[model samples]
Target chain A: NAGVTQTPKFRILKIGQSMTLQCAQDMNHNYMYWYRQDPGMGLKLIYYSVGAGITDKGEVPNGYNVSRSTTEDFPLRLELAAPSQTSVYFCASRLGQGARNTEAFFGQGTRLTVV
Target chain B: AQSVSQHNHHVILSEAASLELGCNYSYGGTVNLFWYVQYPGQHLQLLLKYFSGDPLVKGIKGFEAEFIKSKFSFNLRKPSVQWSDTAEYFCAQGAGSYQLTFGKGTKLSVIP
Candidate 1:
């Protein structure tokens, strides 16, 4: 299974630039998430979607926006990039069951650099 | 939201030596704990998981994690290390919500 897929393996952005990180899943999962991993800081949640048309902010949502227009796509947008926003971004998806969720499948992260 | 903490940022050990990585989690209600490993230049993969039963969970590649609910700890252990086991390990926590929180990963380097 192709699980989760993320586009633009690497990118460079100038300050104040904008870009979008695209994520797609083939497992028909109901939950999708975006996270950024900084050195020694682990992965912090930027946004997540429980299902189509339902999205919510995560731990570190600043400068990021996400939309879940379809079950397979959850794209994260950077309206205005900053140096602090440079990090490896990961997209994950999980099977949405009852009140609890299941294990997630991760994508090959996208490395972003803002200068 | 739940949060995860990993105690070690970096660890180096000789091959065949024992290994242990510490992780702690916090949540108000029931939580699902997991350990994810990322090899160099690869995506993260599930190492082990703990949900309802068996606090001691065994995983692939001879990895095991013990979940101490009373102490809010889940530590990963391996009896013997190999150079192939060198990687970055992340501890994660998932609650009733759709989100999963990860800890600052521990990078392990096993000398051959």
Candidate 2:
């Protein structure tokens, strides 16, 4: 069902360059999130959206921005790329609130390299 | 701020060996716990989760996790490990908020 899809599986960015990491879900999930995974650092939250037109910052939202214009899309934008931003970024989504045995679904992850 | 800690960074075991990965969280309020596994070159997938009911939760691939509220820990365990069980395991906790806090993750290598 293409639970969640992320574009540009791999990319190399120059310092100070800007780019957007596109994420989309077809499951009509109300919760969408962006996280960066670093070695031995697990996944750090970047930004999240509860629903359309509702977005919020996460644990590590510096140098990044996000928007939720629709229920199916939540894109993360990096204004100025830095070497510290080189990591694997994952996009995830969940059905709704409440524990209810619902688990988040993650994307294939985008490997970004800032040089 | 909420945080998660995985005691073991990396573990290696032979096939048929018992497996246990320790996970602890810092939040004291009601929380939903989860275990996620990521195979080499593959996306992360749910291994198990604990919300309520029995403290022991069983998940796919013959995995199970015990939630010890007193200790603030949700540890993953498997009776017998298989070579295919080798993967990176992540522990996460979701509180009243929609965002989840994740542990650093533990990498397990099962030798056949």
Candidate 3:
């Protein structure tokens, strides 16, 4: 299985531009998450979904929106790109709730540049 | 709110040197701890994890971590290091629920 797949490995956006970071998982996981990693900083949670059509904001949900349309997809939207929005984005999935029986699988990541 | 902290922002080691990276979390309830490694130009992958049972958990690439309840720490260690081990390491904590909080990653550089 491809596990978690993220589209557009790399993208550059101008100020005021918007784009969507697409994420898909083939494992049928119930939990999906979007996170961004800035230089020298830890990954910050942008948004998460427990299941299809159910999404929640995380610690760093500002400047972003997420939609979980189907069980396999959860896409993150940057309505207006800013310089601070430049970072490496990752999408992860977990098969179970919080149990150690399942660990989250991460996508390769999308490197975004906001100029 | 739950959060994770990694003391070291960067660590440099020589080949065959023993390595340790400190990770701590703030949460009153039971939790699961994990260590993930991201190699250059690669995705973040699980290095090891601790859920229940033994406090000492072994993971791939000859890595291990000990979960000390009293210290509130899950420290990753390797008896010996290899140049290939150079990568960015992240410590993440998950509480009663599946949502996880990650610390600022530690960049480990094993110099040959």
Q: What is the alpha-carbon lDDT of model 3 when measured against the actual structure?
A: 0.92
Q: Tell me the DockQ of each model, to 2 decimals.
A: 0.76, 0.71, 0.71
Residue B36, candidate 2: how far off, in angstroms? 0.3
Clashes of each: 0, 0, 1
* Candidate 3 TM-score restricted to chain A: 0.95
Model 2 alpha-carbon drift over 4 Å, by segment:
A98-101
TM-score, chain A only, candidate 2, equals 0.96
What tens digits encode model 2's per-residue C-alpha lDDT throughout A76-99?
A: 999999999999999999986553
Instruction: Order the candidate numbers by TM-score, best to worst.
Output: 3, 2, 1
User: Model 3, which residues run further than 4 Å from truth?
Assistant: A98-101
**True lDDT of residue B92, candidate 2:** 92
Candidate 3, A38: how far from true, in Å? 0.3
Candidate 2 fraction of reference contacts recovered: 0.71
TM-score of 2: 0.97
Which interface RMSD values do the candidates have, in the order shown?
A: 1.2, 1.6, 1.5
Q: Model 3 chain B — which ten-residue stretch has the worst lDDT?
A: B93-102
TM-score per model (chain B): 0.97, 0.98, 0.97
* Model 2, position A49: C-alpha lDDT score: 87
Off by over 4 Å in 1: A99-101
